[model samples]
Target: MSNEPVSVGDKAPDFSLQASRGRTVSSAELSGRPYLLYFYPKADTPGCTTQACGIQEALPALGRLNLTVIGVSPDPVSKIDKFADKYGLEFPLASDPEHELADRYGTWVEKSMYGRTYFGMERSSFLIGADGHIKAIWRKVKPADHVALVEKAAAEL
Candidate 1:
């Protein structure tokens, strides 16, 4: 890994991953619109639920900004499928089981829990411009207020 923070104005890496609904989503395909690319650790967890639901509820407002919201995680397609159905998540959830996209965005890093250090996906989000450049990046995000914060960022863009 390069240990580089994918900063504002850097070209966002393009990737394709299986969606929770059995389709493939790619950065190249989401042309001519800004997007909020968020990385979460797991599917169906309490914190993750709060974050996803918040975004779901704010979809309309976010749409007015011409932004697409996408959630990425290291969970398998099957798990993500269930989580999406259970929560009625309207936004697409992409699977990155091998952490390729997460690593590329620098969201995968060493994390600590209960005094134990381990590697995991550090919750993060990026505001990617229509031209494929990153407009903003949020690292180690707090799940509860994530949606509101993302909305704020999008409004500024």
Candidate 2:
């Protein structure tokens, strides 16, 4: 895979991730429908929780627009399950424990914190059009701004 991040208008990378509620979410299954795929560093953290709850709160509005939302994290299935259950998140919370999906989506990235370097999932999101092409990309997203931004993009789609 190229090191470059996925750009808008490119066909989104296909993914088949295990999600909460014993579900499997795949790009093939989502074909011909608009959706939001968001990546967060971890589950149940403050920022992640804020972003997730915001998405959950906006689900009704998003549904009215025929948009589905999926939250992706490096956490395992058990952790993702707990987080979704605890927050009462109705949308799919996908586990990317191996980060294969992250890498494919270009959300897996390098970082430095307090003089140390490591790799982690960047807070990012992709708004995919019904035709399976990416309509928008958000890198290093802020939890506070995620919902409104995605909602607008989905609306445009």
Candidate 3:
């Protein structure tokens, strides 16, 4: 399989995943509108929680920008649901349990930690334009500063 990553100006890949909102969130559904598609390592983890809550805190600004946010991870739908419910996350948290969306987005890769290696989803974010093309990308995102970066990008978009 080609490991080429998704880049700015490429058409966003199509996906259909079960989301925490109890329905499928597909690319088609989000078409014709600019949205932030963010990928994290897992649901309910410390870093992921901080990233998610950061976005939640910025929802007012995001809404004013006319943008929607969707967070994707390789966790099961149940886990995503619990995370959202527990944290009162207003955005949809999509389940990518089989890594279909992660693979399609090229965020699933071999990662090394403490001299051990394994495959996992990289923390990344993609800004998709109204026309469905990527406008910006944040690969290996830092949770602490992700929302601010997205806010900047969204303002430019």
lDDT of 2 by residue, 44-141 (tens): 99999999999999999999999999999999989999999999999999999888888888888999999999999999999999999999999999
lDDT of each: 0.90, 0.93, 0.92
Sort by TM-score, top down from the best:
2, 3, 1
In candidate 2, which residue pairs get closer than 3 Å at backbone N, Cα or C atoms, i.e. clash?
none
Q: By lDDT, highest first, what's the ranking?
A: 2, 3, 1
> What are the runs in model 2 whose C-alpha is more than 4 Å off?
none
- The alpha-carbon deviation from the true structure for residue 89 of candidate 2, after best TM-score superposition, in angstroms, is 0.5
The most accurate candidate by lDDT is 2
Better of 2 and 3 by lDDT: 2
Candidate 3: worst-modelled 10 consecutive residues by lDDT: 1-10
What are the per-model numbers of colliding residue pairs? Answer: 0, 0, 0
User: What TM-score does each of the candidates earn?
Assistant: 0.96, 0.98, 0.97
lDDT of 1 at 98: 84
CA RMSD per model (angstroms): 1.1, 0.8, 0.9
Better of 2 and 3 by TM-score: 2
Write model 3 residue lDDT over 1-157, tens digit each, in one string: 4468888899999988899969778899988999999999988899999999999999999999999999999888898989999999989999988888888789999999999999999999999999999999999889999999999999998
Model 1 error, position 2 (Å): 3.5
